[model samples]
Target chain A: MIEQVADPLPQTGFAKVVLELEVNNHPGVMSHICNLFARRAFNMEGILCMPVAGGERSRIWLLVFEDQRLEQMIRQLEKLEDVLAVRRHGAEHEVFERLEDFFH
Target chain B: MMQMTGAQLIVRLLERQGVRTIAGIPGGAILPLYDALGGSELIHHVLARHEQGAGFMAQGMARASGQPAVCFASSGPGATNLVTAIADAFLDSIPMVAITGQVPLSMIGTDAFQEVDIYGITVPITKHNFLVRSVEELLTVIPDAFRIAMSGRPGPVLVDVPKDVQNQLISFTDFPPRVVSDSLPPVDAEAIEEAARLINEAEQPVLYLGGGVVHSGASALAVTLAEQACMPTTMTLMGLGAMPVDHPLSIGMLGMHGARYTNFVLEEADVLVCVGARFDDRAVGKAAQFCPRAKIVHIDVDPSELHKIKRAHVAIHADVGSALEALLPRIRKSMRKRWLSHVDSLRSRFPMQLPGMDDPRTHYGLVRAVAAALDDDAIITTDVGQHQMWVAQAYPFRRPRQWMTSGGLGTMGFGVPTAMGAALAEPDRTVVCFSGDGSLMMNVQEFATLAEENLNVKIVLMNNSSLGLVYQQQNLFYGKRVFASKYGAGPDFIKIAEGFGIGAVDLDQAANPRAALAQALQTPGPCLIHASIDREQFVYPMVPPGAANTEMIGG
Candidate 1:
């Protein structure tokens, strides 16, 4: 199956995921990252965009899908006017910090 | 250029969401939300007689049509008045979004005029709450709050947007898409496999369906499972149409007010495969002794509910539809002959049967006739008491969410307001409320709201001269002591309703009963039909607390 090959995907059952952006300085760069996430519900959680490094251009983290047209994703990000390196992490695999029983 | 204020942005968003009507009475604290409304062409605000009545009005709209209803209130007393309606929506899982304008940010901790910690108070009763502090942030949180309140497991959501933030100007482009954690608790494969095994092994399996079937839109899936497994199914009060009354596999309602056969079948089942139903105290009286003969395979969306009641032989934390869908393909086709025969025998032995119409003139007779005439499309609401039981016992509900009353927390005086909510939600449908005398008097002030709106609702009062349920308890358990149950000075209900300028009547005989009821139905606006009944009548087939199904009492 394609799911097993050349892939990494967030195991969430949701068909789509959208990442909210909160960039400070580089609106154009953040827009590019959002564009990358908008193409398809890839092998990774789906869409990802957030202000990189407190919204500064130096902190450019191109949110890319782990198995999303990866070759195409990397090529697209690398070709960006302000090109940045990329890293992949599973969305659902985060360690839960705590759960507070604060039901008032 | 500075963008519009948060209040302005909200009105436009609501318009996009098709929220044409809102119910609320504005005050000092919530003026910004009302002020923003001054220029908007989209939203129409209904000036309520009272904040509590407004809350019920919003609820009525939501229950009427499953569309999320909006309500607004100011801080302090305004917010406090909205509490019961919010709690009502919480228990019933109605899609409602309530916005409370808080005091200025500077005035918050100081308890400025009319300020209260509305968010903290509503945390338990609401699915979610937000204390929005900034205008720029409101552009994002406002739509998210509305979507959250209406999506997933729908319930009431309270958004306390502060007055200062509402008035602040902000440059806004468009609202952001909702940000939800991608993490999802996967369905345990082993648990699902074991559940499949136990279901396959049991000969006398009873599929106990609940509201989750309706919640997940799994009626078709549930029916498939029932047919494949060849098991008889029964529903809780909330689970009425999950399995239709006419289905041969469906044995109607269960528990205290359930049909005789439903209790009988449940008492004798070898395996009880429950779906999406928390074994509430009313459903499982004296939990320790409930269905002692069977193994409980509990399936609920909330994981906390598995061992919260009776121990489950196989506990599954998955959507009932998902679980059943997974298991249905693997289920075998052979029917359990002995078990089927046993359930059939029990059903035949104690089928739900009303007392034969002796005079054709009693309260029960009227209820049966009205229910028959209505033909299952009319919505029925009840105030908690003998009348509530009578309607539940007599009326045949063919649709889920058709009969909306206070189910889990049987709040008295809930009938009229809830009926108002249902009528608001479904303006086209005939909303009928069967209220007890004691319960009707709690929020009788809503009569003016009913008359003002002239909503198409049929209000039927079972005017027994006392708190009928309390009277029943006094008669049954309190050594037959005649207590504070009767009213020497009965307020003329006909005059009270007529005072509100609504069509009103009192039913006394059979020849005129049909004509009066038909006339009431034919009238264009709200009708208050009061039927005086003898206070001594008690609901039958009631299994006393801690008693088994067979130990039923009364007629």
Candidate 2:
């Protein structure tokens, strides 16, 4: 759990971030993301997402590693197009939190 | 009026256009161009081991540097050798200038020694081609050839200079008017706004990124619109590197081998915002069933692609980045928590897992480890086979333009040759290739080019002692009736590679597979990491020919 520190230097060692999406809300989407992370080598610790309170759409969060070659990293998230705020929340990122191993 | 040579005029034109290098093979007809190169200070001519490799090398440089690169070949074989690369560059939309020498102008249509219809052979593959007759025309046409190649829907352009033209050097002069600025049509504003409004109102949204994103350099805007609108995204094979792997919004790729979730997500989306992606059959399996439910919003710089396959609910004619910028602010942002969770579940369920590699030296284990180690930043070029599919299905590709393949053509012998281009474009970046026994054999001659050009390409040959993919197809579809899909009675690839002076390591004997890979990757010159794979292994997640996109078989 990376605590939200005051304006840290964008958590530099290969920063890891997550975005929870609910586009398809099926078993297949998560597999796609997992396989995607594996292929791209983004070690996702866990993805704790499910049907939200309203249940009209789904939510998904993926953990990923990035560097200054980071624009493409960000582009990958936005490409999902269903992603709400690909909030960079993880280790060596702007926001930090302790996530249980639900994604594993 | 003074007598002048076309080669001298060409040199002057190329100098003005900032062309510093030319990939070529010296021969009988092109000696004048080579002769013209002796005293020139600006252009560096690379004597390629093969003229075909020369074209690919130039294509590679052009693709990487975003500048028009040049290749030269002599008459007959030299000109014919460059054909494949020229066609590839044409389809891939790489900016290249191919200059082939012909027989003396006096020997027209006589089939003189070392004379071939180089210009005619190249016309179909090039954006534009010219058969030079006079030295006077060289001053303006040489620079114009380069200009046309680099501008609009960038592609290779050919200029066939006759042997006589190269010998007659008139006084060289700078020709600045050759480059045209307003040659192509301007972006259509009505179409752009229609796409933006559709996006602004959509509930279930997804964006399909393609090679156009990379071509337009609009990757940043692609991310912006997807994030701002809470849209899920997928990419075509050519669009692999537009984003990086591991972006949460990215749902892998969409194609015959694309992520199951991607197909399903697009299937359900209300508005599919397609940016710079043509609905190629490879990317959109059966066109009818592809995104059947989504109201497609197609945008591309090429107006023709709008209704080429799937008719767009809203079609836009603008570059993706510029379009995204124009449309981003217009779209209302909403909290689609439910939408997010649904895509997340799809991501979790159909995880692309390969058979676990128990041994380090085994092909299965090595590819998985290498794929995992290299992750997203690494660009992998593959020769077609079980290995290529294995990489396609099992690997995660979140970024656009990350995966480059002859998707539409599926040409064999493309891996190493294309890798030469990919490596040259990004000299500092690592370019890895997965070649099969059958696939590597087609273009084995590329080894000399890889070495001579000094391109950094790491090849992982999945030598199954057979034509693995063909065999797998036969076994599955033809009841294992083996025909010509055997490679057991052939030259040993490692030995063959060694003959070309490239490093080779058998995956069987290598003690530490990962270490061997690291060492090979560290090697500055071209190297082969041959991993003998299971000949019986078949590609999974395959939708049996003519079956629905959802009916994918194998894990």
Candidate 3:
């Protein structure tokens, strides 16, 4: 079994932003989205997902640092067939902030 | 309404998609689909020794025909084995559909025998993938798989069907209409106008072609553009045959193993028009410094590739062929005599040096000899390494779809099976696979498949008793500590070929090697022509990895 190690350098200095994704609700939709970020080595700080529009689609909120590769990552995300649309918001968004107490 | 088993539905769908041949291996989980496939009169199945070979064979068919090809495998190891080929197709943008079997849906997460979550595993490598839950999903999933595989920038798609799903019965009102590529994104007229103006006004322009030219069938238009603008053209490895290598405007392949003149020409360019080719790190060494002075005009069907590397002054999101068609009329044709002369002068000063052409014993000479024996009609495929680089440098390819090699992934064991696939698709044309000894051993078991099918494939094995590229890298970069690069002892490849019931010719032992090579290549069935190469030689004009293209070593 492989051992899990903590990240040596935390990305605290960078500014955070929220990405809102409207995706087709399915078993592998999250896998596809998460796989994109994971494979590119982009860190996701926070996430919240719930079904919307009669459960046909799901809304996912991703909190990530504002890195140079963010634009490329969004472009890659838009390329996915199931991802309907992507919206960006400032880190002050309440979606992740509302859940801060649960994490604490 | 028509009622059919899921397996039968898949076979019928594949036939409707115009797939005539499929390469695959059968296992317990996928047996039902095999049964249905066996009954089909329109589709012929080629049995490969390994799942990976089957996957590459499908890639070969897709690459040669410019159509999405299909392959099959069972769950677990069979599915795992196909990952590399799928990744290879994904990187090279080959249109392929891989269907794998899974354990029954109820037993999926229990770690049942021969069970693996292939749908999850392949998510990263495939354009899209599916794990069918019910028989009903097959109707939409099958067509979607083809559309996803071929639409936009083509890539591989995977469909994982559970054992119970294949056995389930389904009724449908009508079969889906035969699928074609999804309509291409509309060409941006404003961007095309801007690009044409840039080309019209630029003093020193270079047309850089990529695999997209071949995929979009826009090679002719690309050549026309180059000639009309008097622009010197360069191709990535995947784009080798996009312009005839001997064309006066052609600058050959550019990048890591590119000709010195080609990189220098790129360095001096005032305008760089990149079509259908992403600026891959291998193609553009140290991206920040590549084409530092040139204004970029990037045209690709995939919108994301634009501004991803070098920022494009004019980024057109549309099919390459459509964009070229739109740009052709608005562009002014000019004979930039001064720029052409400068390019020609650079060519003369830093010409690609092929050391030996008279003797068939040397590596470069052997490649040339083979080219001389065969015409431009022969489809050339290469396993990755020094031999691949040599063939890319030496072969006089004259047309698109004439050369197929694993470019992006640089998969070593790609040559033999892919050549067999090319042969399978185009039975009239002779296919030659240039392979090194190290690459050949990776999928040597495919020799049996080649003989069984009697494909007109000639494997020209360059035996150097070592991983030539690794040895070269070690010698060049690793302080000459050659560990694990050399083989303890080389196998008798001639006997190995004969053991697989294929014909063999040892060029080293031949009295007149060139004549013997010509004779062997000319003969019909499968044959392996073995020639020993010196391990000391390395691919010349190296970029030293992570360095800029202009900073080169020896030629």
Candidate 4:
């Protein structure tokens, strides 16, 4: 039987902003996006990536803190060679929330 | 169409891309590719002492020529060695195509000898990576890798092929027609209009430029806009040489280790127009409080940078060069006399006072001497350390691509190899590498490659006899308990250079350091000048970690 325990929760209670990106399917595109975040020590709470259509392009959703840099990051994402478009969603987007529920 | 091995296709595709050089080492898995290289004379191969050296050498060439450069390595250790250089290229936005040989497909995930999941390993580091399952993928992958690397926000892309794939015969056809995507969404008219409104209405506006201008080749347009609008400009570390250092509007570098005046001006700005610069913490310093009053207008080729750190009032997502060109006619010509005067006063009041300027032995003094000896046109590459900061502070880089440094990764030992790459790319240009005692040790072996090539690359070694920057940080933050910082008395750098078959000189022991350096700089081949300074000397004007741009310790 599973013991009753208080599972750890993140303390920073920062609002999560989810960014949806439509990009060309390629090897380094994800690395480029992640590298930008990693270089700044910006943490991504959740990531959802899938090939859409005939796999010529991809759709990616990044869960991150709704910090001041969010808007700027969206701009940078749009500039990537393969990135086609980007859209922002609030915490209520439920993409990561649903994933959490599925995992739990 | 002719039939050829997959290895031949690799050479042919590189030839199509006009790749003059491939810097790499041959190994077990990559032998087939080397055999193909032996048959080709159009694409030159530079055999570096190490894979990491090869990577940086490719970076040097790419950075200098603004063309995608190539590097190759075998699987496992060789592939891992190229990782540092690949990561460096990624961070700095240098265009490079890294080719690595993987074990045969049958050995996949079996932990075979000399095998590594290089494609999986490089996923996080490269702009893209490909694991070829068949020889056919090379035809599309090679050209696509070049296109991706050279197109928007240029970076390193990896193409890892298995031994069997390289050996497999494939039909060699005429080079694939280059893929051209005119996919950049047109510049938003309203956004451009809004940006103009902000600039026109604002009393104090500052043009903040980054390496984007260099990558986009928009320096001239950026300068034109700044001058046309009468806007004062400041650059990020990566943005140095974007504008002439002596230009009236050019306020020099901003953020950590920035000139006292530049940071103050950024703080004082009403509208901060950032182009091709992500608001890096080092540049912004406490982002929440950074330029609190300024309405930021960030212009970049990438959409992700806008509002990433500082919220932008107007975000223009387009090629930086095109955006500036379009914005030029719309910018209202207005005078910012008061703001200009204030910036001038800040510069005059808190002038950069180089320590030990009278004595030619200090880091700053020697850097100044070197600057005086070389023209503004000379390319200066630096390894990360106290010496790097000193060069940034003292050397007045007059043009873009003139100064190359590991800004993002702060990689030590990047100097010699990157300088070698740049020297090879532009044989006519003078390439000077500034390195510290600790940093030089990291890639000290590259001296052999430099000597072998006999490339006109000058290495000015700032021997502090310790890990100078780390020691400074420890002294300031860790209560001065020196641990693994000082090298006591460092190795004889002159002897080391001579051992590598490169000419050498010791500034500390030299009767005339400047004259000795001048002679070395003017020399036709690779040379090393060891300038010894006190280990106790620190990189001052230090912005303590997490501090604001205005905050500083000592200069």
Docking class of 2: incorrect
- Per-residue lDDT of B74-137 in model 2, one digit per residue for the tens? 9999999888888888777778899889999999689899988876666557766777888887
Model 4 over residues B1-555: C-alpha lDDT tens digits?
788889998898888778888899999999999999999989878889989999999999999988899999999999999999999998888899999998998997899888987887776677767888888888888888988888777889989999999999987657786543235678888899999889988888999999999998999999999998899998888899999888999888887788777778888889999999988877877777688889989898766666666668998888898888788899987888888898899989866668876466988889888888889778999999999998888788889999999988889889989999999999998899999988999898889888888899999988878888999988988889889998866788888999999998788888988888788788788889888788888886877768887886786
Query: How large a fraction of the reference contact set does each model reproduce?
Result: 0.00, 0.00, 0.45, 0.26
Root-mean-square deviation (CA) per prediction: 12.6, 20.7, 2.9, 5.1
| lDDT at B357, model 2 | 59
For candidate 4, give the lDDT of residue B417: 93
lDDT of candidate 3 over B1-555, digit per residue (tens): 899999999999999999999999999999999999999999999999999999999999999999999999999999999999999999999999999999999999999999998999999999999999999999999999999999999999999999999999998899999888889767888888899999999999999999999999999999999988889999999998999999999999999899999999999999999999999877888787898999999999988898997889999999999999999998788999999999999999999989986679999999999999999889999999999999998888899999999998999999999999999999989999999999999999999999999999999999999999999988988889998989999999999999999999999999999999999999999999999988898899888887888888898
lDDT of each: 0.73, 0.72, 0.93, 0.85
User: Given candidate 4, what's the lDDT at residue B393?
Assistant: 81
Q: For candidate 4, give the lDDT.
A: 0.85
- Candidate 4 lDDT for residue B430: 88
- What candidate 2 gets wrong by more than 4 Å, as runs, is A1-104, B1-4, B177-186, B357-364, B371-379, B394-403
**Per-model TM against the reference:** 0.79, 0.78, 0.97, 0.90
Distance (Å) between predicted and true CA of B184, model 4? 2.7
Query: What is the lDDT for B401 in model 3?
Result: 99
Worst 10 residues of 1 chain A by lDDT: A95-104
Can you write out model 1's per-residue Cα lDDT over A1-104, one digit (the tens) per residue? 00113235554443222222233343234444444445444433333344556546344322333442454455444433344554444444322112113322
For candidate 3, the docking band is acceptable
The lDDT of model 3 is: 0.93
Where is the poorest 10-residue window by lDDT in model 1 chain B? B175-184
Of models 1 and 3, which has the larger DockQ? 3
Task: Give candidate 2's error at residue B94 in angstroms.
Answer: 1.7
